[model samples]
Target: MINAFMQARTGSTRLPNKVLKNLQGLPMFIQQAKRVQRAKLVDNLVIVTSTDESDDIIEQLCNENNLLCFRGSLSNVLSRYFHAELNYPCDAIVRITADCPVIDPELMDYVINSHLKNNNDYTSNCLVATYPDGLDIEVISKNALHNAYKYAEKPSELEHVTPYITSHPDKYRLQNIQSEQDLSAYRWTVDEPKDFELISSIYENLYVKKPNFNYQDILELLSHKPELNLLNPQIARNEGMVKSLKKDKEEGYE
Candidate 1:
């Protein structure tokens, strides 16, 4: 089975309850789940969250939407994915985040197909970041995931799932799916208030006409109204991961 797991929590320091925030009249994560469910290649879809009380809201969102949910470690996200794998057995795993409400299911299937065809231990579209940050997708063999769970020790590696696997490319076969054009400058992720503004505007402009709007539609919208890009350009990409890594180093971590 190929289980697609999306990790969510309500404890984001920068944007608390961002996942549950309303978008197009529904919680943001639910919108993301709807997009992910359109994947033609994935066999199962699961929302993985933490056991913290704050995350209970996430679980309830999954329940109300009738989507599969798993609750695990609050901080150790690698552990959460591992447990989610155990709950819904699968030979390969697709890792996604709740913060990305605009993820493309077609791009997801492309990554999944490439991962299997190349027989890669791990694969992703963001390895070199050709796609926009929010559309990132990662696929890994179950055996490789087990190795990451057993060996990853650094707090950053454990908390940011797939870092342990990608950091050590020499230990695993890796592949990156790149876009024909370099559109990495666009930031569609919902991490801060400005991000939500841009995303909400995108949904407002396109969701009504095309409920299944894809990346191309977003690019067209941004092209037509270039001012939309200004909404969240100030926020750096992967700010949370950068903060975690910096914190680890400040505390005397190597």
Candidate 2:
């Protein structure tokens, strides 16, 4: 079974108790989990939180929803993920954050299908699609995760999560599924106050009577109201390391 495992905790330094923050009468973490389960691509979905004291609320929410949940080290996320893969019956694991409210299930299916079709060990939508924020998806074989658990030695790898597995192109066959329709300017993931505000706007406008619709339905609604993209102009970018490396090169550090 392919598992979409979400890593979440209340220890977020930037926004404390952000996951417990309500999005239309529902906790943000729970809402994100529901979206993952609703996705057509994921065979099974599990919320992976930490054993830290702050994550108690996450554990309770998981129990109430009857969703599979795992708790492990707060900092060493790679180990937490590996433990989840071992406990769950997952052949491949999809790494998803608990902050994405507008995660595209169709795009997730595309990434998983592309990985298996191309016989790649690692695949992701963020590698190429660049569809704003909420559409990020990463699929990696269980073996690759185990390899990361054992071999990844850097503190950044333990903290920031899956980069070690994807960075080694020689060891893992990495593939990216690009969006053919060109919807790269959309924002859906929740990070800061502005991100949460943007996602709340989408939920307010789209998820009124029917809170459960696939990605295509979302696109149809969003296309008709193109101004929603302006809800948050500064879209989040996951290219921090790349940007830092470029700066280093300019400063003669590389």
Candidate 3:
């Protein structure tokens, strides 16, 4: 069974409680979860959040919405993911973050299929980043996740789940899914207030017409209204990972 673990927390440094921010009357993460449920290949969807007291609301929100929730370490997200799998066993794990409210289920299934077909230790779309930032997906084998959990030492590796595995490619088989057209220029992730505005605008424009709007639908909408892209411009991708890497250097892990 393939379990998709969506890492979420209310303690975002960029935008605190950002996942709890509402989009179209529902909390942002719930909206993302709804989209993730549309993927046919994902046998189960689990919300993996830190056990910090601040995240009590996240668990309550999950319970209120009838979504599965697992609680683990607040700082070490790799530990959170590892323990989540221990509680809910699966053959492979799909890693997702709650910030991407506009994540594409079709894209997720595509990556999952590739992971299974290639029998890769790790498979993801973001390694080369052909897709938009918000559409990133990572499929990790049980063995790979276990190895990463046991061996990862750097602050960056521990904070972001797959960095250790990705860094040591020789130890694991890896595959990256690329889009035919380069769409990395677009950003649909919610990291700041401006990003939320762009996501809200996208949902306002597309969700009413098709609740299950794919990335293509978003692209089509953006094609006519290019101004939406300006809402959250100049923000770097994976800012959290960058910060963690800096911490790793400070701690002499680099």
Model 2 TM-score on a 0 to 1 scale: 0.87
lDDT of 1 by residue, 52-96 (tens): 997888888789999999999998999999988988999999999
Deviation of model 1 at 193, angstroms: 0.4
The CA lDDT at 33 in model 3 is: 98
Among these predictions, the greatest lDDT belongs to 3
What lDDT does the true structure give each of the candidates? 0.92, 0.79, 0.94
Candidate 2, 140-186: lDDT as tens digits: 89888888889876665665567787778889899877776666777
Go through the candidates in order and give the clash count of each.
0, 1, 0
Off by over 4 Å in 3: none
Over all chains combined, what TM-score does candidate 1 have?
A: 0.97
Question: In TM-score terms, which candidate is top?
Answer: 3
Quality of model 3 by C-alpha lDDT: 0.94
Root-mean-square deviation of every model: 1.0, 3.3, 0.7
What order do candidates take by TM-score, descending? Answer: 3, 1, 2
Candidate 2 Cα outliers beyond 4 Å, as residue runs? 216-227, 239-254
Q: Write the per-residue lDDT of candidate 3 for residues 36-128, one digit (tens) a residue.
A: 999999988999998889999999999999999999999899999999999999999999999999999998999999999999999999999
